[model samples]
Target: MIFAYNKAHVGDVLMILVKNDNGADVTSTRCGNVTKIALKETNEVVAWNIFQASEMLGEISGVGQVVLSDEQIALLNEELAKEGFREVITQEKNSKFVIGFVKELTPHPDSDHLNIAQVEVDNGEMLQIVAGAPNIEQGQLVVVAKVGAMMPNGLVIWDGELRGVKSSGMMCSPRELQLENAPDVRGILVLEEGSATIGEAFSPEKHWHG
Candidate 1:
């Protein structure tokens, strides 16, 4: 689930994206201030538009992909119940960007330039990521943008396939992270030894001028 609010550009509305519709036909049903967007074929809820969101959720401040607290999710559920929608909101608590240690690396079967990597984040949790950075190597500590991350350019990361292989996340470069003074070159950002603990959230502020 992804929640975004941009009062300056989008007004007092909260946009919720629950699932990708995959270009399927969709329908919107509005009840009061809540509009449920669903896939027409299966009637699966895919997104939502909550108008006057601040009045109900209280002071939602963010440009994109705002994380919702459990309390706020409960409030949203209450509103959904009032409108008779059966879906309930759930809080996704994982950090979108984190430090990852590349545990394995191998050549992609179908793509010569792409590589398949097994990155470890969140202690023992592992993610299969396909990367194209020339500098990517096994046993390196790099930044991993997990599924559901909103990049600096407003791109949302999602589970995808690269060259017929499933990829769950991304290996980021400084340029992609929008770090200040990022080198005008191509490669994944490699962290110095002991600079950060594996699985910890990656703070862009620390690397703005690094």
Candidate 2:
């Protein structure tokens, strides 16, 4: 999740995007302090905007470095109160990223160095993706930039076609994924299995998979 606010530009609400891509046509439901955003057809809770973030008790996991503004937290609380959800915001934050396991790898049909990979994000879901990095290996713990993720390069993850094949998110390389000081090389990043938990914020456990 990302938070942005402009104090000097205008007195507007801070924006937190649960889903990276929100279409223009959105349906909103206000339940006390929580506001639910959904598509008309699916009614899936694609995004949530709470009036107060602190008033929450126990849903969040992990320890994120984020410090939500009082206004933003209050907004989330207000929305939550409206929703009638139990007042439960957890002190822990969920993982937004997880180490993906590459189950299969294939050469990209249209690209010289790119390869198509079927990566499992520990969520039990497999995604077909294209990557240019070379050292990607099957059964390895690779970093997964799942769908709806926003790259440090400002690239938005979404469904798209690559060389006649439909690609879902991306398998990250330290450089292409835009991590700090990622090696500027031609290999994909392989996460040490012990480095990351199975799920939480960036992890599939915390993120919506279905």
Winning model by TM-score: 1
lDDT of 1 at 97: 91
- lDDT (CA) per prediction: 0.89, 0.59
lDDT of 2 by residue, 85-142 (tens): 5442322233334567778988887888778888877667788888777687777777
RMSD of each: 1.6, 7.8
| lDDT digits (tens) for residues 97-145 of candidate 1 | 9999999999999888999999999869999999999999899999999
Using alpha carbons, what is the TM-score of model 2? 0.55
Clash number for each model: 0, 47
User: How many clashes does the backbone of model 2 have?
Assistant: 47
Stretches of candidate 1 off by over 4 Å are 206-209
TM-score (all chains, Cα) for each model: 0.92, 0.55
